[model samples]
Target: MVVEKNVSLQRCNTFGIAARAQALVRVRSVADVQDVLADPRLARTPKFVLGGGSNIVLTGDVQALVLKVEIPGVRLVDETDKAWIVEAGAGESWHGLVAWTLQQGWPGLENLALIPGTVGAAPVQNIGAYGVELQDRFHSLDGIDLLTGEAFTLDAAQCAFGYRDSVFKHRAPEAQHGAPRGFGLAGRALITHVRLLLPKAWRPELGYLDLERKRAEASVEHPSAQQIFEWVCQVRRAKLPDPAVVGNAGSFFKNPTVSPEQCQDIIARDPKVVHYPLPDGTIKLAAGWLIDACGWKGKSVGKAGVYDRQALVLVNRGTPQASVSGGEVMTLARAIQTSVYERFGIRLEPEPVVV
Candidate 1:
């Protein structure tokens, strides 16, 4: 473990925000994590487990020790008649893992291509794109308890995954020490590895209309998992801005879910309101459409601005002389929230973990 002080976190996060970490430690293995946690100097202080830094906003200089998990390895743990069980280290890049699985002709994770973050972080948010989510393939995960230095396995039900939330986000307040904490960083519950179950029968879920359109153009009668993966990558590349060029964390807000009656009322007011029916008969409204409808797209406040193509994306366009402030991001977010609430009586929730 290499611990450095006053490290700039600009390059660490996908948003490219200029923030500093008091102490930054890069751990290549679980042993390294245990060693760092045992170090008495960092025991009581707040700690942050950073993966690909894609789903976070460094509001200010992080006061905690930012532990960057870099452990890397993948393996086929079990193979049965139903599915192939595979496990990957928490540190492995998510997209890299998806590409590797597609190469092996894995069926389940094809629709999740191009998602930013690490394997461990996937389960944290139940990452979803197109019409699939991580929970669909999740088997179990091994997490190290922070306080006792003991390890435990969390099965699918144990994860308690919901839409963009899990036990990692909503653990009982009193059971903090033993259970996973908010953002899966309570009292040492670090994800060391994640196991996934992939199907032997490749059933391509062409539920998303855009993806289906692309497949139709290709004349693909029965798209293989690999082909669907490629198409997803293409769609993402076309729609989302590359964080390397434009500073962003993809969709900044989760599409707000509301009752069917509420959706009907909003649609009655403006029939163009984009929405989709959920499995529970509820309605999920497009947050981007809400934000854009308020005429916030291409709007800028100092260095931070809403992306021209996607209203949900907030970009940093300022130079070194005019650095963006946390206030600007908050101000913009609050404005969008206020507008959406006033218009549709729905409060938009930010997807990125805002500090």
Candidate 2:
């Protein structure tokens, strides 16, 4: 139960924002969290559960006790004729889990490969790439209630997944957009393990245009899961800057969904506007296209800049010593949001949680 104080957090986050945690604890197991809860001084203190720090923006030094989740393990927990259920510790790298599953002959997770962050954070954001969302393959997850240190498990429906959102991302019923929205976990819970239901009769998801293009280029009519995995990696690598070389939190904004009327209005304004129709009749507009339309690509505001290749990505342009501050990143993000809204009449929601 060693509580470290004033720890540097510059490298902990993908944005490379200069920040620090006033007090931090590394939780390697469920008992570690129970220890934290049992401690007199720390029990009631405000706490922040940090995973890979891939989907967050630090506006300033974290004032709460930072519980860095580092639990680890992966195994095939169950198998049936329909699927293979696999479990992984929340602290495991998401991409590492995907690759490992593939190596073990699991195929459903291949479409979600190369996404940054830890497995625990995946359900928090309901991470998705290509055409597959975490909810699509989610079996169940085990977590601890930070307030009471009570352990529990939840199935997919209980997670309340919706468009890169989940119950864990909300603070109250009003803030939650998914079903059974009356309950919002937010900071109240800490995930320890996630189980995924990978189908035995696997099928490659090639619905996205980039994936379709890859298939055409490769001249493979029916691509294998491994091939699709490689293609997705290539597509993402070409558009997204590696967080190691250049600091970024992947897509900075969520693609805004609009009504049919709004989509028509935008189409009339700019016929070249990129959009995809949903099953529910709403249209999802590309946030990158909107930002690029507003001429934000390759532009910068102080130390925060939009990546040239992908307009949706907001990056830290400064070096390690003089890195971008969280405030700078938010400023640039707000500016981009304002511009895109002014031009397209659609408000873009940022994907990362601004801490």
Candidate 3:
């Protein structure tokens, strides 16, 4: 394990925010992680496990050892005429895994193509797009106990995944022998690998209205799984700003779920309020529509601005040196929350884990 002192984290995070870490360690394997954890310096300080760094926003200098997971590889473990089970190292880039699966003719991940992040972080956030979520294909995950240095496998239920959240986010950090809760950090856990069960009988899921409209307009009689994957990529590219060029973690906020009565009241006030009815009779409102309706689309403060096309995304247009501070991002987020609350009496929560 190589440990570097006072590393600049501008490039490590997708947002390109300028931040410094007290110490940095790159872990390419579970053994490397264990070895690093044994270091006396780490034992005295906090440690942050990082993957692709696509979904996090650093507010200030991190006063901990940032472990960048670099483990890589993907493999097919079992296969039949109907389905296949595959496993991937947590450090593998998520989009790379999706492309590889498409090349191998696997279909379940097509809807999630182009989502930025590492495979290891996918289950923690239950990453989803179009109509598919990571939980829909999750088999299990191998996570290491930080204290005991032992590896444990957790099934899907143990993950406790729910709409962009998992056990990795909510559980207390001191639990030594249990599954991780809240953000894959905290507790004695570190995800080393993830297993996925994919379908062999691939079929296109045209659940998103815009995607369905595009397919209909194109007159695609029977789109293959790969073709659908390409379409999702194209649509995402057209809709979401690329973090490499514009710098953003797509969808800064999640669509808030509200009771049916609240949705009815909001709809009565503004008939155009976009919402979808949940199976349980609740309602999921369009967060982007809400933000745009509040006139925040294309708005900018300092170097950060809401994406003109997608109000749900906030982009960094200038250099990290010129960008807004963490406090500014929080202020803007709270403003959006307040605006949406005042208009519809529903609170909008951020999807990205703000640190």
Candidate 4:
């Protein structure tokens, strides 16, 4: 439970924003978290749990004690006639977990290949790609309550999964629009392990147009799980810049869902607007398309720029020595949001947590 002071956080985050943690602790196990809670000084201090650093924007120096979760492990915990249960430690790379499951003959996670961040952050953001989401494969997770120092587990329903949202991303339940629907656990919990339920009877999810194009190119009527994984990787690589090469969070905004009438209004304005109708009656608009339509792609605000290939991704145009600051990123993001809203009458919600 050693606390390091003035720790440099430039490389810890995907955006490569220059910042430092006032105090930081490496949490390698559940006991480490308990120790921090038991300690007289840290117990009363506000803490920040960091995992993978892929889905966050550090605005400035973090004043709270940072708990860098580094726990690691993966195993097949249970196998029933219907499904295979796999458990992974919080610190394991999400992409690594996907590849591991596929290698072990598990097929349900193939559609989620190449997503950035740790396994624990997957449910926090409800990560999804290529017509599949983490909630579709989630089983359960174990975590320690930050407020009580007590360990607990939760099932899928308890997670309150939504589009790129979950209970982990919210605060305690509060009144909102005259309702009690804002139930959350935002900073109150730290996930240590995640369990996935992969059904034995797997089917390919080729609903996304890019994947269907890949299947057509390969001339395969029925693709295997491995094939689907490869296709997803290829499709993502073509559009998204690798975080290693370009300092950027994957998607900057969530695809906004709107009512049928709202969709019609947008359609009347721009008939070529890209969108998809969900299983429910709501229509999900492509945020990148809207941004591009507003002529934001290949544009820059200070050192923060929109990725030329994908308008939804905002990237750092500066070098590591003179990296883009979090403020620059947010300024650019706000500008994009304002323009999108002014043009489409839809407010764009950022996908990453702004710390």
lDDT of 2 at 261: 97
- Cα lDDT of all candidates, in order? 0.85, 0.93, 0.84, 0.94
Q: What lDDT score is found at residue 206 in candidate 4?
A: 94
Q: How far is candidate 4 from the true structure (C-alpha RMSD, Å)?
A: 2.5
TM-score per candidate, chains pooled: 0.94, 0.97, 0.94, 0.97
What does the lDDT come to for candidate 4? 0.94
Q: Quote model 1's TM-score.
A: 0.94
Compared with the true structure, what per-residue lDDT tens digits does model 4 show for residues 49-95?
Answer: 99989989999999999999989999999999999999999999999
- Residue pairs clashing in model 2 are none
Give the alpha carbon lDDT tens digit for every residue of 1-355 in model 2: 7999999998899999989999999989999999999999999999999999999999999999999999999999999999999999999999999999999888998889899999999999999988899999999999999877899999999999999999998875553554334578998899999999999988889899999999999999999888998999999999999999999999999999999999999999899999999999999999999999999999999999999999999999999999999999999999998998788888889999999
Clashes (N, CA, C under 3 Å) per candidate? 1, 0, 10, 0
Clashing pairs in 4: none
- Predicted candidate 1 versus true structure: per-residue lDDT over 1-355, tens digit per residue: 6789999888888888888999998878988878876888876667788888899887899988888877799989999998999899999999999988877766789899999889988988899988888899999999886666788999888888889977776534445465533344343577899999998876889999988998999999998888888899998888788988877888889999999899889989989998999989999999999999999999987778999988888877765445576667778888889988887788899888886
Residues forming the 10-long window of minimal summed lDDT in candidate 2: 172-181
- Residue pairs in collision within model 1: 146-188
RMSD of each predicted structure:
2.4, 2.8, 2.6, 2.5
Error of 2 at 296 (Å): 0.3
Local error of candidate 4 at 313, Å? 0.2
